[model samples]
Target: VYVETGTGELVPASLQRAQPALLEIPASLDAYLKSIGDKSRNMIRKARKLGYEFRRLTPEMLGQDIYEIRTSDPMRQGRPIP
Candidate 1:
């Protein structure tokens, strides 16, 4: 199944524990929610109330958007704070 490393890397199902074997089908969202504590869930709710949306990013979309955002110089990128 899908597992996240401690450093926040999303390990694909192909790389999961197969020796002992997991019972359930791999799902990133399910594993992610289980990994976090209750406080995180509360924060997600609070952010959602302020017009935020949650989406799981694909590899291609992540490369274009999130990767670009992180690598870009904050001074050069003038996106308004929401």
Candidate 2:
């Protein structure tokens, strides 16, 4: 099991596991692109070349699109869809 706390606080001290990612998005896309490593940047470039454009999200506009995008693949990596 995993337990998380603030920087100094800890409960169970003996078990130290790798912490899960905490994403902190930059204010702009360019700033974000600059922050990631080269391999990730290359993937983004390839995605852009393949015409995968970024869409600004809105409650009514992107709900269906997001649903289709996420549910299109029933199995991703080695896990089954929830």
Candidate 3:
């Protein structure tokens, strides 16, 4: 009654067609930094020292920001719609 594609390769085939992209979540910040390696860790530390705050934005918050970014493009020639 139901079919699911891209969920994962539930059954193995002689010629496999697709595999889902899997994201691994780190248990802690130390684990995340270790996964990314030293250079990326240093860069992230520097960004934080420079007062950069990384966060998630809701759709409501992104709506106006997205519109502004899209319309601010000089190549669009004053057209608000992309």
Candidate 4:
């Protein structure tokens, strides 16, 4: 699990409840869609139709966007956000 931590050094840790899943990023979005099943592909298409998009946050968006995203989940990783 490559979950990001604030700490710089690598430290060993364990979670009481963890369902680690491995995901592979295909060479292209079309290839990714092709790899998934019919249901998943449909769900992704639906989200796209709903105007949901995938974009990397720029430096200018890092502050507020990250804050909003992190705060939206009251509990993250293994602790409370606040």
What is the C-alpha local distance difference test score of each model? Answer: 0.75, 0.83, 0.77, 0.83
Could you give candidate 4's per-residue lDDT for residues 20-69 as a string of tens digits? 89887799978987888999988988999999999987768688887889
Which residue segments of model 3 deviate by more than 4 Å? 1-16, 74-81
Task: Score every model by TM-score.
Answer: 0.33, 0.42, 0.63, 0.47
Clashing pairs in 3: none
Scored against the true structure, residue 7 in model 2 reaches a CA lDDT of: 72
Residue pairs with colliding backbones in model 2 are none
Runs of candidate 2 with Cα error greater than 4 angstroms are 1-22, 58-82
- Candidate 3 residue-wise lDDT at 28: 95
Compose the digit string of candidate 3's lDDT tens values, residues 1-82: 3334597545544644688789999999888888897899889889999999988978788998887887677566555554
Task: Report the number of the highest-TM-score candidate.
Answer: 3
The list of candidate 1 runs beyond 4 A from truth reads 1-26, 55-82
RMSD of 2: 7.1
Candidate 3 lDDT for residue 49: 98
**Per-residue C-alpha lDDT of model 1 across residues 9-80, encoded as one tens digit per residue:** 988767535577556644787787787789998898899899899778778866778767766665544774
